[model samples]
Target: MAMAALTAATTTATAAHVHGLCSSSSGFNGRKLSVALPRVCAPATSKRKRAGGVAVAKYGEKSIYFDLEDISNTTGAWDLYGSDTPSPYNPLQSKFFETFAKPFTKRGLLLKFLLLAGGGGLVYAGSNATGDILPIVRGPQQPPVLGPREKL
Candidate 1:
């Protein structure tokens, strides 16, 4: 991913579009650079059954692993991927992406990723059978009544 820098001193260039992660070095003096931004694309309204299914999607400095099942159902499915926290065990949520935009200022960055869950009961309508408009004209209506010819 590409990273671009923008100076806050200049009022004309207020925002900068970075392809990947944005950190403190991403901005100039006085300007504050933000890291990955959260972007939720879960269906605004859905009646689908939530389960223990988890999905992970990454974009720029943000790595999202969310599941509608975890939010809706009582399955108690937990997600601990791509976290900065360390664990005593070897298996722990690690930081896949990081952005240090600034120690104090946190702005000027955006990260977007979409996660869509299976929709609720889908209504599939049967296709209507349209009668053929033209009559079957290629083949003869009746089979040829062949007669056994005598030996020539």
Candidate 2:
């Protein structure tokens, strides 16, 4: 009963097409660089939900998520995702491949591994400090998927 009205809203969802080449560091650690200069927009969405449509996405500093918005005259549903943070189609993350997520593409594998391993060791520890069962957090955060919020 509650889901029908939410479905009435219209739709079209896709990845954004942000412009600007990610310039490389001149030296190993050159002067500071920039991505999309912050333009004013509504405060970015924080908590995720599914009031109208089942939208699931993730956000990054430079638009790596999906965007949904409202049409001026439509009397239907709005379809969107993520923080609408603005990002173009990632060449690295196609349907079949994600070999070079932004971090890796920018910082290489060795550095990323060292950082993660070092951080995790300090945080999680080698031996099980607590005896109770625990779930290992998969990895770097992906957009939270809010939904049927049900169990399988």
Candidate 3:
């Protein structure tokens, strides 16, 4: 009974001491977090191409839909790219792309996994308190050089 009373008293004292120090509402509760940078691309007039019996733009590994008639009707569209007609593809480039481009795409999962494992190992070694662990796992140390004091 005494132990329960002491715990209750301590809890009440801690609560009272921390009263008014915390606010239930924060200013950032209603704000949104934006994680992407602004999108940038080439101008629309210089991005159209007519190939494989369709008017489309080369978007990554696939051709995307485009409106050639709309582009033709637009005033001053002919002034773009010095003549406004789509450029012709080189035969050698097209042959190489058709032969061996789809088989090799970039993959970085293994590199990311190795980096994550190394970071986790460093964190585990730092947090575990035992004998000397600095010699086996350590990073370069640069001593902080103090400069003259500021007058602020």
Candidate 4:
């Protein structure tokens, strides 16, 4: 009896909703279910104003205006970083490479040779240790047979 009343109320609510009317129906747990109707709203007006090619926007009581034509043209902009002039310090033009090259004097020659030889020895020792500890198989391996195969 309760189920029949609920079904009738749901049908009436659905019919009213289909005819563009807001209605309510009792849900399965006896809670009211509301149907929303479409509402008509007016279009919003722009708060911005234009004079010549410049656009002005108002924020609260303060108004700010900027020229649209000068936005893309950076000729009148200030040179903050001085990008037009050449920089005083350049990495490629500096004397940084001279330190790595062998000098005419024999000073520090032995130290440089010892450092290079020690680095190469350490790399070789690391490669051998890694290969021994983690032995990996390289190249194609034979696949395991799952079932008895017929003589082909």
Off by over 4 Å in 4: 1-105, 131-152
Ranking by lDDT: 4, 3, 2, 1
lDDT of 2 by residue, 1-152 (tens): 55764343211011111223224433346753442433559865886664897665655446444434433223344444246664577754563356445456565776978888999897777474764445454443565566685532
Error of 2 at 85 (Å): 36
**Candidate 4 on 1-152: residue-level lDDT in tens?**
99998788777656656633433434346555565535668776675565567566663334534455565343445655457766587767556655655362466887788888999999999877743353244433555455556432
For model 3, where is the 10-residue window of minimal lDDT? 30-39
**Candidate topping lDDT:** 4
The regions of model 2 sitting more than 4 angstroms off are 1-93, 99-102, 108-113, 126-152
Q: What tens-digit string does per-residue lDDT give for candidate 3 at 1-152? A: 99998787666545444535322322357443222333568678766775567566673345534545566553446566487555488888888896675433425655666788999999998788665557546553665566678332
lDDT of 1 by residue, 1-152 (tens): 12233333332233334343333345446555644434658886678768886786663245634555456343343564356675655332233222243322433222211111112112222234334534564555676676678332
Write down the TM-score of every candidate: 0.13, 0.17, 0.17, 0.18
Counted clashes in each candidate structure: 3, 7, 0, 0
Error of 1 at 72 (Å): 54
Pairs with steric clashes in candidate 1: 23-101, 24-101, 37-111
The count of residue-pair clashes in candidate 1 stands at 3
TM-score preference between candidates 3 and 4, better one = 4
Highest TM-score scorer: 4
For candidate 1, the per-residue lDDT at 70 reads 53
Worst 10 residues of 2 by lDDT: 9-18
